[model samples]
Target: MKILDANDKELMTVRKIERDGNTLVIRGKIFGAMPMVARLTPKEARAALKLLDFKTFFFLLTLLFRKG
Candidate 1:
């Protein structure tokens, strides 16, 4: 799955989208080999990055668990 920006630019390739508490967590492979951290917004997830840790968690999981 792919995430596109407002202009339709590819932001990240997603593996899964999960909800944690009042936040939405996105798990995916990013920038080739880097672990990316991005948190979901309370209202609009795409608006800001409030929680960085959640993003890191998802990133690691996707990196380690993604099947070849």
Candidate 2:
């Protein structure tokens, strides 16, 4: 998955996601340069989850299974 900045420019390309204990590890790159990792604590994870409500969750599911 690719992350875009506020200006819609490429910020980072997520390479992998892993769970470490109570943290969610996101491995990615910035500007296609050095590797970067984001460790989201449980609190932060919950905050992020709030951004993906039920309707959005189902939308993502549909997109995932949609045929071109």
- Report the number of the highest-lDDT candidate: 2
Off by over 4 Å in 1: 4-11, 43-68
Residue-level lDDT of model 2, residues 1-68, one tens digit each, is 99889998998999999999999899999988989999999998788878998999888889978885
Q: Find the candidate with the highest TM-score and give its number.
A: 2
TM-score of each: 0.45, 0.68
- List CA RMSD, all candidates: 12.4, 2.6
Query: Whole-model lDDT, candidate 1?
Result: 0.70
Runs with alpha carbons beyond 4 Å of true place in candidate 2: 4-9
